[model samples]
Target: MKIQYFIPAMIYSLAFALQASANHPGSNLDDVMSEKETFFQAINEPDAPSFELINAQGELKKLADYEDKIVVLNFIFSNCAGVCPLHSARIADIQEKINSTPMKRLVQFISITTDPGNDVGSTLEEYGQTHGLDPINWEFLTKKADDPEDFTRKLAMEYGVKFQPEEAGQQMHGVVTFIIDRGSRFAAKFHGLKFKPINLILYVNGLSHQEKKQKQSFLVRWWEVIYYYFIH
Candidate 1:
């Protein structure tokens, strides 16, 4: 994949301050902020929560099955007029770019609906079709009958987004696009619609070339080292 390399101002601004304080401690803020860093915020590397969900065809799907491929996950409801449409469009743009490259098969896209009641069968399929999301690697999903009414929304909460039903039948919620690394199981999140679509593509492109590392945190690294020498 061809990468468009440009640092976002806000992300670079915050990243410089944080990395400088954490790494150099006494470095000048201006100098620290000038240092280049990738903005895919490394978290505690939480295990991405997976649950039972159904696609537009009402077939059961599980997140764990995609362990061999990179997963780009988002939350949206078909009936939403606010951010969901724009969010879907942005994802569509990213998909078009990805499909042109070899990264296409390495990635999968999922958007779980907040309005499963309205988005079913053809309705769910049309949302993806309208957005030009390729069905081979993308799915617009909803909860099956056995799952709780709010099961999918509750799962979205695990990814750090909250949703509540508005009086007009729309939901008040935040937009987050998540990238889950294959096998390594650590998930990184890109928050909000303001982030560039190319930035996300660049990130996944990086992950595709990444040699899978087992533990990310310093503590976890040391613990594993000690176990290998002593316990093993």
Candidate 2:
């Protein structure tokens, strides 16, 4: 896939700081390294939660259903007249730039509704249609209304997204996106305000290439031959 690249200010800022502090301790660079390392750990960790959600078609789908592909997931309610629309539009812009990749192979986008009570299957369908989402790959989902609280909590904890509900159906939450690699690892997190689809694709493509190389190491090749040569 032809990956789109867009370097944002924050990336250059953090990277420069980390580069300066790579080998020095008890220096200003150390603090920058610590912060960058913390961010890296948060993104590169192996655990990515998979949950059941009702898709726009009213069918059950799991995050695992899209295994072996780069997945971008975000949480937003259809009723959200605030940040949700802008975030979705930003994602659409990114998709347009990376139009060469196959929808199923290179990327999949999912939006999970925090306001499950109102964002039903039909509602999600309407929302996707309203946003001009490419139904071939993009999906809007709502958790079952019966005790959506548990699912909501699971989603928040799994993706490290914070969703706070308020009276009159208003929510105070950050616009966050999670990128899951082909191996289903939490590869990156994009704060809503800082989320740029091209940047996400570039970083995820880097991770995908890295994982592919790691799988082809000599140790992996030897183990694979030992484990499967006799059977096949």
lDDT of each: 0.67, 0.59
Give the alpha carbon lDDT tens digit for every residue of 1-232 in model 2: 1212322332233222222111111122222223433332235556578787787677888878887667878888877868989888877666554444423246788888888778875787888777867776788877764654647646875677677778888777777777776667666676755533534544443333332333224323432342243212
TM-score of each: 0.73, 0.68
TM-score of 1: 0.73
User: Native-vs-model 2 lDDT?
Assistant: 0.59
Instruction: Tell me the alpha-carbon RMSD of every candidate.
Output: 12.1, 12.8
Candidate achieving the largest TM-score: 1
Q: Which ten residues in a row have the lowest lDDT in candidate 1?
A: 20-29
Q: Which segments of candidate 2 are over 4 A away from where they belong?
A: 1-42, 102-104, 210-232
